[model samples]
Target: MCLGDISARSQDQMILNLQGCDIPIHESQDFKDFSEIGTGGYASVYTAHWKITKTKLAIKQFFESSTKEIKEIIINEIHLMEIMRKKVIFHPNIIKFYGITKLKDEINYAMILEYADGGTLGKYLRDNAESFKWENQLKFANDIASAILWLHDNDIIHRDLHPNNILIHQHSIKLADFGCNASSIQLEILKGTREMPVSATNRIFVNLYKECWEHEPEERPDIDQVILRLNSIPKSHFDSKENEESEIIDELDLSDCDVQLYY
Candidate 1:
């Protein structure tokens, strides 16, 4: 992300062509020709620029053989986004979806969202860990909590909430990738202990689906409760090292998940 020498040189280029761009999205298109920003079991994210607005956007492309199900999910997500986007909202920790590419095919589907320049929080933490102050970390934790609360207020559960999905922009936060987002009532996890501990040190992916992977769906905490847990995340509760690029690699290997760390 260091544009230093390049800032001196003239590298007028990027993954997606901004001067002229196009989309013929279908349920079948493979969404090729670009570096994948992120790849999960069902989808991959790409870096894109909106020609109309000339703004940076993160395009998450989902591949599905089931045409009906794909379209249904796409439509539902679009509707949910439309409702949530009605208000002008901004946060330092949550990703925001702009709009969606007009659905053309069943296999080709993508969501357009604001670009998270600093990349994933994991990457940011690593890049600045050497000198980042405690105040910055505290602000981040608080910002994320607020965003989760906002989503809950709207009756949506970011079932896949985690650090890698979170983005930072000039110290602001934006949560990204809502492919797994859903609207559902929540219960609780009898952790034997009083409540589920909101731990930031936990690796991102491992924590996002904490309750979903659990045998009992009832044990999953609802969005509101999730908000409380996030809000309760006291910065002073724990101390952490300045995240390093090395740590990012180690954690990814431990999680055994293939994902891009955009530090």
Candidate 2:
């Protein structure tokens, strides 16, 4: 169904909920200076300037070919964003969702998101591999861990997690691309029965990575434990001015924290 042609009741409810969550609905004219940045199976991403806020933003526009499927995906993502907004789970490492826009004479709505100047984390690592120090690598790991912790705590699983899905902006991590493939069963079973392989040589985070990649999900460490281990990395590995400055992990008290999984 076209976003603009939804049933009156559904449209009204959506508009009311969006207003309650402070998510603005705008027209295509609200943005300018569009440049196609990326393309995916269902949508094309563009860098545009939001005329209202004067901010550089990424606009994800779904294609019209698969209208029904694409519409559901868009609604699901927006609903997840609404939940994040309501629960106040806005973390520095998570990509920010601003609002949505309907293009002129178009059937689909576009998502307005934070623009990442540094591009995907995969590209960033490849470009700076030689110059990237352990301190910097640990920082990225901690950032990803923190975001994953928050996401898991809030019952959201980024099913399509990968280096490309994890973006980098201004030298920081921004978790992105929460697609519509939510597993019906909470338990995600790995295909193989073999134990997760670890590197031969000893490295500071090798064990941590191994624990996280355990064959059984139950055998893996929780995000909180992963974060605690990550926090120890900088303190245990290096004692330089740069490491001290690059350390971004905060003292988080998780004693009373509760993890709730929404089905």
Candidate 3:
């Protein structure tokens, strides 16, 4: 077969795979007022107003001059988003993927996503460091865990999970930036060994964190189990703990942990 034939077959297979997925193909001209918001290693995101719906949306456009390897990564992420959409139509804590649009005079495609009004979690936390309370911290942790559970339930692993990747929509968390990474290493747990301040409820949380950081991947608790553990920590526990003098938050300080990331 000629190269043209192979390319045609590959396109056919992609269409077949996308059949019944119900994801829309949007036209680049349908959006206007594009303003760049964020940029990553592979793609740059823009805020655009959709002409059809008259709604503001985020347009994540992959770099146009990307190599074949980078293009493949972009395509893989599209497929991953499609798969997650197929499994769950809407997830409260996860970012919503609307459709795709090809930029004018460009071969690469851009993804239409819901706009997060409050920006990234990292920036939000930094801005509100002074007034951030225990209750707000609890809610953020729960929201993140809930989003991770949804991903795992749909057989998708969010390999790039961090505060900057997590966005704030209104006052809630929206998990984003799903990337490709399969290898894993153990993260050090700083519950028992560290001399950080801890309450009864916090001790339970620390134990759960330790379980999640188990050296053996199989021994680690899944996201679902992690959620259950979080829920099990009674509100009363936090109330009692907060009633006392507030030294610091109960979360494990990553700076104290010896976590080494490769690539």
Candidate 4:
């Protein structure tokens, strides 16, 4: 089947599962002070404070009385998050999934997730395009590649691998939004924004991007091969010094530095 058809099938299955399943929904009283931070076609994300844990979190709230397509998408996303949680494969480059919540009177469902202070990589690059260093860009690419490799290793394909789905947290890349089952080749070309300067990006990244968006799915390298290629790139100054204990300590101390990139 074509990518669009595959996605349609998946959505149909998800809708059926959602309608038939009796999934328990937790009370939304645990979260407070929800402030809208971001939004997508399916849901709106809010930064909320978890009353129980006293920690900040991102709550993705699905629209009330949404259409079947949007409901299917939300259910699929919840299903994917449940899988990740059950597997216990908590890779650093992947966003941390918490749990789901549903208010008693509201028709909308909410998903609790790790709050990414740095926001999406696409926004970060747009805001800091002029001053963002090449080395950091490479690091972000490596981190994203590693995350993708982990997902593939676990038999999950990130069919929607775009900059908006890639988040920045603690100055590191964390891949997000893996609910859709569309072909990667079909969606690869739609990964970045139009304003992004493709020519200005590192040559290695440019080549990798081209390879990823190839028309033939079989011709594209698997995630492991992609990781190998990213690893082969020359180490940055910080990476080179990581071998020294003192330098490692310094790096740990500087972990909170504001240089953040995504995707």
Give the TM-score of each candidate: 0.55, 0.74, 0.75, 0.73
Task: Name the lDDT value of residue 97 in candidate 3.
Answer: 80
Candidate 4 ranges with C-alpha deviation above 4 Å: 1-25, 181-197, 235-263
Error of 3 at 57 (Å): 0.4
- lDDT for model 1, please: 0.52
> Which ranges in model 2 have alpha carbons more than 4 Å from their true place?
1-23, 67-70, 181-189, 193-202, 234-263
- lDDT string for model 2 (83-127, tens) is 665565488998888768876666666788899888876666555
- The lDDT of model 2 is 0.66
For model 1, state the Cα shift of residue 144 in Å: 0.5
Tens digits of lDDT, candidate 4, 150-188: 787887777776666788888999887766743334344
lDDT of 1 by residue, 1-263 (tens): 11111121223211122122222222213223345666654556777555545566667665653244444454455555555666576443555655445334433446766677787776665566456565565577667767877877667766665556677887877776554543222333234322233334444323544653555667776556655665565555445555542343334322311255531
Error of 1 at 3 (Å): 41
lDDT for every model?
0.52, 0.66, 0.66, 0.64
How much does candidate 4 score in TM-score? 0.73
Clashing pairs in 2: none
The TM-score ranking, best first, is 3, 2, 4, 1
